[model samples]
Target: MENINIKQSDGAASLAKVYAIANQKGGVGKTTTALTLGEALTREGKKVLVIDLDPHANASVHMSYFPETVTTSAHDLFFDDADFKSLWGKIVKKREWVGFDFVPASIRLSELEVDLKDRKNKGMVLSNSLDEVKEYYDYILIDCPPHVGVLLVNAIVAADIVLIPIQTDFLALYGIRLLFDTIKILNKVLPSPVKFRALPTMYDGRAGACRKILNLIRRKLGDKVFSTVIHMDTKFREACASGRIIFDVDPKTRGAQEYMQLAREIVRNENA
Candidate 1:
């Protein structure tokens, strides 16, 4: 790992905390964390923008925005040769709830990796696009894909902080080394390298193996690991199935409370 620093630009419209929820390994609750944290932040009176960069568009589906119905999406943001401001206007879809907006992803994005693989400034596309409406958001959260590719690279490049949601399992940690290596390479090209924190998710306190993996992750990452751990709960899947935020489904549940704590922890980490 290399030393990373965050640079605050004066040109930013609002001091939005740009976070990319990324992990090379799938099934680690990346989308779940992104949506939950975004909603939690909104409850705290912060305006949040969630960008679904995954072609699967689970976050969008969870929010009830079907890909077939979405006219302008993240695919347009990346592939359409239009001015970012204009594209931003076209792509951003406001949620029924105030203070939350998102750029849904379409299956077309799966084809984008090959389309822009040869583009000179492909990695910077997302960063430039988000700058157009940065002032309107207090936090910009991107739900990245499960693999390292052009899309993932764009997300990492655009982010101020890369939040890795790791499940409390050995398999989830298997390929994280590759993710760190990718970050190190990308950071070398950035003026201010993006900082990262590994968050342990889907933890089951009763499972000895889960607890062991969490401890092992802490030992390996040390301070790079967040203090807040998201324990596994059935509420996450239930909330997603119901298309409601965990807070709305069951605010008093441990799952909801943990997500709220994670949101606060992120805010404090950013300020620190």
Candidate 2:
């Protein structure tokens, strides 16, 4: 894989570092990491925009925007040829509570595979679309779907970094090889291979199995594994139920603190 290079457009260089939070396996805390990291980045005084590409719309709902009510969403970027000005004005919604911009996901996104099946450059659609507004933010977080398909490809193609949240358990490593293989295949075609980091989530220090899995992850991936580990926290569920981020629910909690550390790590790495 090539050294990390942020995607640059034709005009002035884009300030945004796009991150795709993805994992082929479900229940791996992809949405949680996306939303929390977004909020955490905002707390660090960075402008963040989260693009919800998951058809389940978990990130959208947690941010208090329901897909059913929105007329335009991330789905429109895939199908419509609307100008950046129109799309930005219509699709991006500001969240006052978390202080980040968001593009909600629509249930209609589930149909995009068939809808754009015949299109030649379906994967490049998102990369092209994001370039229009990339200069406006410091970070753009894309919440990808669980399964691999057109939407996942679009997200990967558009991202500078792909964050994979791995649940620390006996089955933690299961099916992850498939995702690695997919990236390898993409690297054959991309100008630069997508950079990725594995974040261990839902960890319980009391559980020997969790510790063993986390150790195995670090042993297997070395520097690719993030130092920050998201411990199992019930507050995450409460925050989701209340339609707020962990920081709003309780900033002092481990869940909130760890995500903040993650944001700092990312920023520090960029500077390095």
Candidate 3:
């Protein structure tokens, strides 16, 4: 884990690796993982960028961003002539339990699809824009919109990796396969070369249904899934409401402990 923080020149400040934290379906803790992991990565001394593509601006709101005040959003990136490089300058450096920085999403992002549909390179707009600022952070986590559209294609095109957060519920059981199929089609048709893995969130071991979902997911995905599970905890809510990472809010809490473990797993996977 220390080795990952040593800065091996994989290009945290010079080259950015875009990771799309996506799932077409909603309520999967997608934003939660983005905030917590970004926080953990920052704590490990890695610069992290979070892009909010969801119109709800949940990530932005969770980060204490007031949509009324934010003029530029992901919508502007796709429409406005302002160089996307300038977008990097708009980054609102957050004060979090972890020291990582983030670029917030605005409520106006919902206008992205309708705004970019007429453009020729609409699907690749995000990727082209990110090229100008890819070198500033080690990780660029994009929180995708929860539906299939031009916005989603843009996100898929921009990502080198996709981390899907699957909820431990019966509803999520079928959605996983559907999401994978969508990814496959995107790779085949949209031609976005992206790799992906599943990370179970809001895990509850006490529930028999939860255990069933976990076992089924592991049985199918094998080691592609993360080893550390994010358990349901009160501290997570407190941290999210406060725009702080779980560990920053309460290092001894269940949510905080699992996130730290998840951070180590991320490093290990990168090393392997």
Candidate 4:
């Protein structure tokens, strides 16, 4: 991958391409996309780090780190005053099987909205924290919660690109507008507007409604919509349940193939 051209707060160039996988709608494959794409990027020999910002900790559980069991997690980044260099080893857990590192989430993150409500520059907290260690990886993917809150704002502010996974359904379409509006408001104060792409997920070709919605997304969004469409697959659920990536469970499956293609597209796009 080519250099991302983003700079840290200290004026040093950042090595990682930070991607926030976000959507205010639930069951839209936000966590799935984050994990699967992290796995796919590793297949291409990229160093990847996935940060679970969701209080629900679905990604943490899938990666075999429970919210209650993890010694330290992403939650600490928000509340702890220690330098990230000292906390990095403790917060970032490596999964050898998946070939990536991740910052797990805990239930404590659920209370951050209330805890940080009065804090100054709260949205920049994650961004500032990530600047301390972004050079260690080639890509950093954040799995954001399915809601409009301080957590989601922090993720978007910290990201170079916000990858919105949109399920191919009517109600899912409404989520795009909500998130876009949020991004618009954020851009007013951001140094630069956050870049974003819409990814169609859970598509079933047999369902006419799914096909129509996919078409509508592309028609309305144009090139903002990714060329790769993630088809509905039971293997993804199985892999999550088994704590394995799709490539490990069955690389031959369509779900695995699509994510690999998506990774290649990202690599090529960055290189371009």
Candidate 5:
């Protein structure tokens, strides 16, 4: 399987953390962050595996080939297996974006919850699968489903850390609290604990609601919030549509630079 491996020097994998880029609210740049941040990590020469866990397949859409596609997706990994060896082989090397491999999301994933929700040890499925082939990469990022469902639970159950992208608005803070409550529930259910940090996304500093929401998030979540706030940038979505990451599209753009800084911040904090 030809995969995207970083050629530069990104510090060796310190924690072996599986970070799930998650959000219950749509349009908060969850998939955008996953795609671009993975690219940024690759730029620094770190291996990254992105698992598109959503049935909507938004992450796959952003990162993978759209029209002419293959079938090795979340559904195939979890439900299908005539032979597990070929599963990892399906990971295509993204020539356009360096340093990342993707487990694409299938349309059949929409049927997963209704199909496998009641199965035995349901939450462990994706985690167990990753454990089987985790040595192929350093960082694993699961792009979770938009709601609190079986898919979300499975991702949360497996994550070492979670990066939540929250919009800067009034109701956004309330929704994020609900997401944290979900995390607490999953923490109690899983044997190993998971850590989390919230990032303010789609921010407009001129808006009072943006300031209010940030204050509320800081007051409630405190230091768990990421120091970098991602301001509104249309180029990011345009980059996705153009079949590339923000940094690849325009490295000098504020949004692209902020995401790069976010990656460095996370890497720096691992030792602290």
Candidate 6:
């Protein structure tokens, strides 16, 4: 497999490609996509780091770290005035998901929205924090929360791409427009070369409604919709319950296969 050519500037290290998995709708499989896709990328020999920005920390739990037990979390990195690198090193946790690492989230992150209310340049905190360590990985995936808040803004400001995971349901479709509107407003401010795409998740081909929604999304979004769709599978929930990724629970499952295909598409598109 060919690796992506990292572009450096002025002798500074090339930063990792940051992809923020976000959707204003809940139960859209954001955490699942972030974790599974990161693992798939790791399987391809690329260094990947998944940052759980959601206070729920479902990705952290999937990585075998309970939210309550995590000491130094992404929350600490944002609020604490300690050494950035030291805090980062301490917060980042190594996972058995092929060689990928992740910075777990704590419930305390839920308080950030109100905590940073009047702070100057609060939107750029996540971006500034990531700049220090982005060179260490080839890709960084951020699992954002299900609502529009300071955390989501920080993730968007820091990301090079926004990967929206929308479930193949009518309710999930309702929030797509709102999410894009938010991104549009954010783009005006940050002005970074951030790309956006929609990925259909929790897809069940047998369900007529699922097929219709998928087709509708493709027709409306065109090339912005990923060709690979994450099919609905019970193994996904089982893996979460077992505190493991789909590949670890059953590599041959449709869930694993779809995520691997999604990872390949991401690599092909980004590296092209």
Candidate 5 lDDT over residue span 77-104, tens digit each: 7774455555556643455555677777
TM-score for predicted model 3 compared with the true structure: 0.88
Q: Where in model 6 is the C-alpha error above 4 Å?
A: 1-13
Local distance difference test scores for all models:
0.84, 0.87, 0.75, 0.89, 0.76, 0.85
Tens digits of per-residue lDDT for model 1, 1-272: 11112233455555677999999888999999889999888887677889899999999898777989877788988766567766777677766643467778898999987898789999998888777777767899999998889899999988988999999998998768778989999879889877899999999999999999999999999999999999988998888888888887789999999988988887776668
How much lDDT does candidate 4 score?
A: 0.89
Candidate 5 regions off by >4 Å?
A: 1-15, 80-85, 91-93
Per-prediction CA RMSD (Å): 6.2, 5.6, 4.7, 4.8, 3.1, 4.6
Q: Pick the candidate with the highest lDDT.
A: 4
Provide the lDDT at 64 for model 5. Answer: 53
Q: Over the stretch 17-121, how does candidate 2's per-residue lDDT look in tens digits?
A: 999998888898999999999989989988788989999999988887787787878999987766755666678887667767888999999999999999999
- What is the descending lDDT order? 4, 2, 6, 1, 5, 3
Per-prediction TM-score to the true structure, in the order listed: 0.91, 0.93, 0.88, 0.93, 0.89, 0.92
lDDT of 6 by residue, 78-197 (tens): 786557766676777775444677888899999998899999999999998888778778899999998888999999889988999989999998788888888888878875655889
Give the C-alpha lDDT of model 5. 0.76
Worst 10 residues of 5 by lDDT: 1-10
* lDDT of candidate 4 over 1-272, digit per residue (tens): 11122223344354789999999888999999999999899999887889999999999999888877787889999977567666766788876688777889999999998999899999999998888778777899999988889999999999999999999999998888899999999999999998999999999999999999999999999998899999999999899889999898899999999999999999999999
Model 4 misplaced regions, further than 4 Å: 1-14
Model 3, span 83-187: residue lDDT tens: 656555554344534466655667767776677667887788888888876676777788888787777778888888788898988898666777677787877
Relative to the unseen true structure, what is the C-alpha lDDT of residue 128 in candidate 2, on a scale of 0 to 100?
A: 92
